[model samples]
Target: MRSNIPWLRTIEQFEDEAIASTAVRLAPMGRIDTDTLLSLHLGMTDQSVSTIASRADAIAELAALGSFDHAKLSKGAWRMFKDRIEFLGCVLPVGWLVPERRRLAPGQMASAGENARVKNTWLLSGLICDVETGETLLDRCPACLNLLAWRNLPNIWSCQVCKLDLRSVTPRQSPPEAVAAVRELARYLLKRDIRLPAPLGDLPSPDVLKFSAWLSYFRWLPEDLGLAISPKNVPAGFLLLKRWPTCFDEIVLKRMKASTAEDLAKGDVISRIKAAGTLSSSVARLPSAAAQAIVKSRLETLFGFLDGSSEGFQDVMVPISELVNSRF
Candidate 1:
């Protein structure tokens, strides 16, 4: 359905602080009705009344289905409203209609490197998952199983480690498994919140909250995939390395293989571990206090390849784009 909601970046920037202030601006003296609320808060008008009502009706239906509370319709609706609008906006420009567009919106008026970061954020948000395992895409050096930093590669697809030109390297013989998931995600994003398909198995179609949480973790891609997969209250240090098929060199692998939690605890490394409440703030989202600490200590020791590198997140997203294109 056609939507008039604003873009993802626009809604994301409309802070809660601004909302209250904007509400006050709309009603200087007293409480306002829904019509006034729409006009003042969202810059709506008579011409757009139908559009707003349709969206509200959809949210109301979802609330009826036990998806969320809509009785406190104004505030709850705004949050839900922003998410659906932003997602649908992304769908047109970045997801389904990408082929028809000539170029992505430029990063002009943004500070240095901001454009690339924005683009990568959108790209990462489009990740196609293994519906069963939640395993997303990753690009690796087939020879060494090393994660290829595609941003640093030459025009030719050369492996940084074994120096093999992978352009002619045949893809795996396995069937393309992620195609259905990718389409399902795109359809859910383009349309609105609905029950996910049978293949997804009762996972709620992607919503603002779910997408936002994933986006938070997604900003830190391949390097942080370790965190994305870690479960609540679990130690992530050694477990993260053991859980995922990550790429590590012989020296680093040997160091990781030989190290114990005690060794990690004694290691001298600048830790970024901080309290994040239930937001999965532990390093690599390690839930165990000791695990978080252990992973914090060894972060520099183990994943030193990404240490102090600005290119870690942006450069690592190339594989996702490639994976998406392969399906088409």
Candidate 2:
């Protein structure tokens, strides 16, 4: 064992150098997508297909474990790769990795800083509608309903006028009638995607849209559970509800069944509304109570126009009373 020490040390030293060089190349890239890896070029040399495949497999294997511990995860991956793979050296130069895509995120890439505003506006849409003004209100002292300016109210957590903590201020909630109207508008927009404005063509991906919608709508439940939600987040709360068949309670379900001939028609609004609410800022920004009242009035008129009978109109209106008690 003593005689073999020198030989073992030499092998270890070489391996350490190889690992360090390999790490340097990959560190900046963070994680490479499959297609990008296939055609990867470093300086004047192109990476071998076999080398990329092995690296991809190793990364996939580590990801499969779903662990948050970086040290433990890396160690495990290293052990598995020790026998089969060797990190000879990086095939690419550092210069090749420096690109605009790495520096500017998807949201940052959006023209005129619209990405952050879009998300913020979506999160604040319900509150905007709740206000009688029908305009986007970013910073208002919730306790006194005094408009707060960025120059005066530098500290967001505290209210300038009321001197009360902003988090403690309860938001003015829109009526259920307003919420249903917003949902109906969301449904209409999704069904007519061809009519969507040119500016909103770059909406978030499907999964992100679903998550944002969920967050916007369901934020109220946490507030109900004694969470200190700021009044500014009130619009986010309204945005959380999605139009699933199960989202509505028994009464609304019965009403929908009587009105629509098919179960597919009943579930249609639920499936479509998620996409609608996520993509269109205009739909989200519609005046809450005002929009609902408009929708209700239009719907009543249309129903009357289609069926002149008072009995037929009464059947739909009767179910809408149950709309006030809707859960979705």
Candidate with top TM-score is 1
Q: Compared with the true structure, what per-residue lDDT tens digits does model 1 show for residues 127-237?
A: 433222333323455678775432222211345467765543543221344444444444444445544222222332332223223333433444555544311111112
Every model's TM-score: 0.24, 0.20
RMSD of 2: 21.6
List per-prediction Cα lDDT, in the order shown: 0.31, 0.29
Q: What is the lDDT of residue 117 in candidate 2?
A: 18
Model 2 regions lying over 4 Å from their true place: 1-119, 122-139, 186-328
Q: In candidate 2, how many Å is residue 193 off?
A: 4.0
Cα lDDT of model 2 by residue, 71-127, tens digit: 332321221131122111211112211111011111121231211111111222223
lDDT of 1: 0.31
Q: At residue 238, give the lDDT of candidate 1.
A: 18
The lowest-lDDT stretch of 10 consecutive residues in candidate 1 is 96-105
